[model samples]
Target: MAPKPPTAVTRPPISDSSLVYVPEDVVEGYQERIETGIDWTLIELGAQHHRRKAINREAIPTITFSDGLINKINRGYLKGFLDDTSCINLDQQWEQILPATLWDNEKFATDEGKILFNGINCLTDDLIKLIYKAVVTGNRDTLWSELKMAEVLRVNNEKITELDVGLLEFKKLVSLNLCGNYIMDIEPNFIPPTLRALELQANHISNINSFVESLPHHLIYIGLAKNLLTDESVDAFSRLPFNLTVLDLSDNDIYHLDPLLDALVRLPNLTSLYLVGNPCSVCATYARLILMVLPRLKWLDSRQVLPTDRSLEPYEAHPDDLRSSYFYFTVFRVMSAPQPPKPEKGATTAFHVELELPLLDVERRKFLLYRRYESLTEILAPPEEEEVEKAISTVLRPSTKALSTIKGIDVDEASSNASNVYDHLVTKSSRVINNFTTFESNKIQWAKVMNFQEPTVKIFCPDLFALRNTFRSVITVNLVYSIVYAKSGKTEKKSSHALKMPTEQRVVLASIKCTLRNPDWTQPSQHFHWDDSLGTDEAIHWGDRDLAVIQYTQAPVKVVKGKPEADPATSSRQLPPENLTCHFGFGIETIRAS
Candidate 1:
């Protein structure tokens, strides 16, 4: 009893799990059966694999999709996915499905499809399929027919060197931006007919004429800034359709304004023009000249053209005005004696007198002198400082007389003998006679006191001058006088006067003041003078002079005598003489031999 109790206490409960052993022959046979079963399964699997491969090869299309075509399909599938409401918030689903559905379809995938997709982005599958069809068939009209809904297309900065004419087939494209590209030349018909605004700025485009000619007639705005453009290219604007209203030509090599302006004139509806960074932009009076020439221009150089700018007149006088107003003067003399020595010799003498006169203003005097002696090139040349100083000096010199004169003398034998007897008297009397012919002799010779000369004095033709130290103001003056000679001791008067002398002589003079209506002598307006207080025309006394004992000569003296009524149509203001010819005269007297 004690041994049984000990055994029960020593052994833990007998284990339920244990390894078993089989006979070697039985194990070998089992191994052989296992190998046979593995071989049978392998054979069946190989047959199934071949059948699946054959099915795949037969069912799949022969067309191979290029990487680009796959990308295009991917983009189009993604766009369609986004457009479908059911695919919202299912981008991961689309990413997994698109490659398998469209891109895997080898029937549509092609190299040309890849190119079409690479040229444009953000298109729908309908458009992608249409474009793919066009590329495959080389039918651009099919592509355009599909893209009729596209209003704008931007392919700027795309590294595109040449434009694809197929892109221009988009019949509904309204705005196009191809700026910031390497595009140098654009082929004709490369722009759609529906495009109204086009931007080709910052491109290597140099054939602006061809580009302009290729533009659609309905285009209203075009930007061509930062391109290789010159004056020649700008002339293309004239041929541009009038519907174009806005143009940008900044940063081009347009040096002359005439061609550009002429081109602009052809654009009647062009109200906005940009020429900043052009050679003509830096010219003086550029805006004014442009506004004046292009009357319809409402905006220029980024600023609005004001009414005042359009109304302003040029500072320089017109050429026709200068030609009509320019004038100068000359001097001559007449002499008479008391008696004739013989019938062969005449009793009077006439000769030309030489005198030096002053210039009116330095500027006008220099202008006239330069115009007379120098070519237009010299006149327009930029003056050096030294040349300016020399001009001033020349203007100040007394030798530079504005009025020129000639001199001569005619005398009979008796007068010559009397002159020898009175040689000293002759010189003194000659000095006295010269004083009478001097500009100072005329009481109303304001030109002397004013120090004014012809052409130069005409400058004051637009100004009012008051008498020195007096409140009385005179607007104009008329220097009316002439010289004549008559035969001494002869009762009959000849119709014509000649240069000769007798035994004695005398002198006559006249001067007067009047008011003129129009001071601008350059214009063709009528001109006349009248007394200011009396409101009547003033006349000069020809015969009333200090010298006496002389017969009147046949010098055709048509003198204005009494106050005459002013012509209603004529201007009463004194103006510079219209004709350039001026006349001055002098006289002398001689007592008879007792």
Candidate 2:
């Protein structure tokens, strides 16, 4: 290795021309190893443009960008954001892009554009998917028609303190992102009635009591990371109208652990929680308390929580266990997946998972499983001497190799169960509405009696950990998919529900009574390469038969047009397709969130 080349610090000035890269100072110890090829793998320092290939799926309509979101300033419904996208750099000043005077300039017309909208003349639902309207000022009704039609709005990093952005006027708004602002409190009715994902991360929010009770029942993912949340905000968690699957409180002011723990228990559907930058996370027993307290939590901080993170032992004895216990956790990450025009047809031995949705339909499919117990200590605890003997005598015996029946004194799956809760939110292009799913309480152990990769000296509650107990824990899991109707849609018959009602319709195409019997205690945790159960329903196919994959269709909560009422009343109307199709994969132990 030799260091001979001198490097320059700055690159060519940014311009409309193609981007070019320049070299910078070499990182300390590796200064002389630029040419070294380890195992024939050479390191190349280069830069390339991230080309965003357009999605060919018909579900996502192309979002037409107007002059408003372009480099030139325009006076219209869309205000602020001189750049193409909605983002304010950490150190970006407000005056640089969001010029208040430019939007309110007297030169702009004030015709309200009601006639041009209303989907009759210039606008068709197919042509437009999303419109970026930042904030309201001057005349609140200036963009009234466009605002009413908006399903997803980004008002991030606008230095807004009060929740007085006139967002309440949005009738069909579903996903509202207000991250990187100065909001301190979420006033009553501040959130739109139809919102599902409220992203408020990187704000200055502190008080939550004023708005938790007012949050719409269907709202699921709430991002409040990098804010000023405290222990007081934890109580607001109990008042949320619905279960939250993903919550980000990573960098906040919360200090105590018990009150936060007590509050989180109210949200039984919470599977992923972020608390990295808070003071409480620095505690020695932070991960242990959270993993044990919230049995449903899957992702914590930078890694996925595993069986090793949970312990039935007392906290006082946890420090000693921490010194020895070990497992693997995957780092939290975001990946860009661009596929070919059509999926490659060939498939054989490699276990693969794929989801095919209608173009522009922003839908998410997730599969999750956990023991119903809040504290798995009893089940995973060191087995009692007699119980171990019973398991050895009853389940692990050589004579019982072919015996499939259970004896009278075998294990039981009667641990106090907590319901498995996760909501299915449907989004067509920019629209997102709530769809619900219910699961019966079932005994789901996060880990087996013994792991396959371990020195298998661990004991279990033998009578409880018997193979029979595993069979007894079998429960029904349903995989559902549905469609939600918006306010602007009309049926072919021109029914009354389509006239003015905010009705939603559900179509459950797939519901499988799946008892994802885990592997013979060796239970290949996540490495199962089997797709034995492939249920084909046209475009929708189900595979990965290890644990399961599910597409939740909201149970009909309300009736519409002389039927079981369920309507979201969105502006982008999605009439139920005459021919419905879905693709689902189950048994694979992978939970995906969007």
Candidate 3:
């Protein structure tokens, strides 16, 4: 059979080289031959042309491999055995040839591979090999010694997902830059203890508590920008390592600074802090409040903190404003009414006394004197001439020229109309005393007075001697009086009927004892007085006057039935007089040393 028609020239076994390298070349040669072929009308050519057209219509024009073939190629590429250039059409291949698992392996499996994949342009294989050798040998001293010459390792924008534990074996690495990566979490102990500075900007980290807890105590600077940090997350820094001096947390999701500020105060050694692009940065008083809260911070948001930004110290009141030295005076009035069958023999009469005092300023020499008795309508009524004279004589003696001058009264005029002038003086003095008392009381109320320096005096009914001894600094004394008169209708009725009146309706009185002191007592006493009844038109006392008036007497006055007579038993004795006076007055002078 013509040797079985040459047995169809059984094809030799395909060699591995031809199978691997001749497929694209042979396809190209056949495609060129078919394109330039003659006889376009022959049935076989027509059939071949129809088949070629049909294949072209059914297949993708840009792709030459079948789906199975592409998948096989991708599998090989993912195994790291094939590159983009090995494909016939790289644009037609899947965009990503390597699987996520293979990518992780290539970037994190070995130190040299990680360095290369991390896009660390400044690193060399020599350092990586040394690190590997040190890690395998478990010799930290050797690693530290080798890494001492190079203290920084930056692998920024590397798209690295995980950190190799072997990398942290370098004990001498001081600064580490892993910025712009896809790292989601940093397990504890991933950072070397010797690192002083670490930068982790633009990453997918949400919580850093683990990293913070494992941080080296010597770390001084850290950058954690463009991360998913919140106010709650910042609380992790409440117990930050004391040596961390610089911190950056810009472009985070922090909404409130209160928690962050609360945390920052715990980092006593942190001098510089950055919080730009956070929500708290929009506050107008953010920087001012920060400087106030963090007094030791030297730099904030990359700007030097000025001293003016700090708040002023608390205000303290001055000693003079406290009204430290002051005095007060009180006045009391006593009224006695006669009852039916009044007080026979040794019965004691009862009088009602009322005392009222107000605040005074002794340093300023200010006092409040009684102007008008509120309970007495008599003081407001017209007064009799004799009663006015008596009141004036009691208040202004003949030797009180200084007081007259102070009262702006002419001695001659005052003597001629002593009652009217004295009435005017009393009214004016009351107004002045009330006004000054109110003003000083308001001042004391408004100011922050010192408690220990305030002097207070309270007195009820006491003996005259005890009252004088109570205030030893008093230099002068004066008793002022205001008289009340019955109404016109009442006076007419009393004159017609001549009926006895109750003491409450017949008498009204008030008194005030003013205590005064002069800081400069060396000056001579000045006195001017006007009293026509005393047989002195105008008198001036050159020195201090001692006027003694009996306040009260316990013994009742005794009256004789007839005239005085001699006693027979004792020849030198004489009987008592017909009448006796219950009141007494004495005037004395004090001689001062030159």
Candidate 4:
């Protein structure tokens, strides 16, 4: 291939009446080259004046410069150069020349008046500031990605640090990528809160704790690889929001992976972790330990490095095992919405799950099953194997298919005796929290039972808070298919409860005077009402008020057997919606530091 002619880098000085024009001979030369029909594509290099097209009310082009020579030059010359050139050198000399001519003693009030200013590259920091300001305050919502400021450097020789890059005008700048730089210290208040993604990989940052604190909570991805971070500042990294997913702490001086692991476990939703070049000797084992602690982790960089080899020796033995044996851990994740009494369109509620198991290490048979629960009360101990087999033989009349599925048991009567486990436990200490007593025990043992038994039932109101004119407003909505044994006989009944209050309860004026503290209620509630005066029937304040239990007001409600009728006197003991509601925003009372 023949060598292409190099274009001369010559830029004319901008003047009020220079009549900046592209030589017509260059366009004619390109046309002649094209007509020759050579194998190589011909490209013309020249600068032409580009006028801004006026926009009409309909956003349609009302008028456009009809200079045939300029249009043809743009289409034929500039298009060819952009298409054929190996690399388009946009960092031209004109940007510097133009800015040098524009900057004067006065601070430019508006970017609009600078009709001749082309933001290509002006070495002066003052000029960049003007461009930055213009980009920020202009009608166009400019993101850092769109503002190609990196290309305008007059000289890359100067040792530029975070202090040197004074982004006073670029206040709207959110995401910044300073991956390869000699930046040492990042001032706390230098960056705007709108900034999110910060990539400062190859920097001499010894103390990133301040940087982490200064960053906004909206930060999603923070890459600080190849830095001189010591163990002393490692704990400060835990202060980052739980929503962070991608954290690259690979090539740092981080030893003793336990603190990092603990911090990782605390994150509610961190899926990807990259810690390859750190001081992790048995990195595989360490990663597995982390996985054992954090069940939700999907990708670990060490796993990608050494696949098929489990880091931990024991877990490596059981290659086929799906469950990680890291002493059971419960993770709470946000749920979609509240389970309403009735579904409403477009209504959203958030929920979180809490794992219910004691973190214990043992070779127990029940530890195999990973049961997810919102609370520990839901766990019921399983029954014994002997009793389970007996129950299976007597209660369950196994069919041919059921008999064939039983392990090691023949299709004869032995198969009928074989119990189906996983559903129920035959343990004595298996306790279910009924209304009598809430499930207070921390541990719930499962029995290797004979027959499959259903789980414990829980009853709750559809919208307990919504129900008015009642005491003990919302009742527990019980779980279905839970069978209970009665002395009369074993009966299958719907696990449901009724909310009833006492009648003929008289309110004494002394009770009101002794009980109410603030005597003012700001929020609304269906439960209690505030009496207007210190001793009058007129009620003023309502809703949930923070008050101390100074005295017992009244035992206003009594439970009646069967479906108890609603009592009018028990109006104060109701909730707004008589159903199960999922609480999302900080527990009922959200407290911030004073």
lDDT per residue as tens, model 2, 184-244:
5676755677889888876556767878888888888888876667777788877766667
Model 1, residue 453: displacement in angstroms?
Answer: 39
Which is the better candidate, 1 or 2, if ranked by TM-score? 2
Candidate 4 C-alpha lDDT tens digits along 45-68? 100000001111233222111222
Best candidate, TM-score: 2
lDDT of 2: 0.39
Q: TM-score for model 1? A: 0.32
Q: RMSD of candidate 4 to the true fold?
A: 30.8
| Per-candidate clash tally | 15, 37, 7, 48
Give the Å shift of residue 419 in candidate 1.
94
Distance from true location, Cα of 219 in model 3, Å: 1.1
Give the range of the ten consecutive residues with the poorest summed lDDT in model 2.
43-52
Task: Name the regions of candidate 1 deviating beyond 4 angstroms.
Answer: 1-148, 314-594
lDDT values, one for every candidate: 0.42, 0.39, 0.42, 0.34
Model 4 weakest 10-residue run by lDDT: 44-53
RMSD in order of candidates? 46.6, 28.7, 46.2, 30.8
For model 4, the local distance difference test gives: 0.34
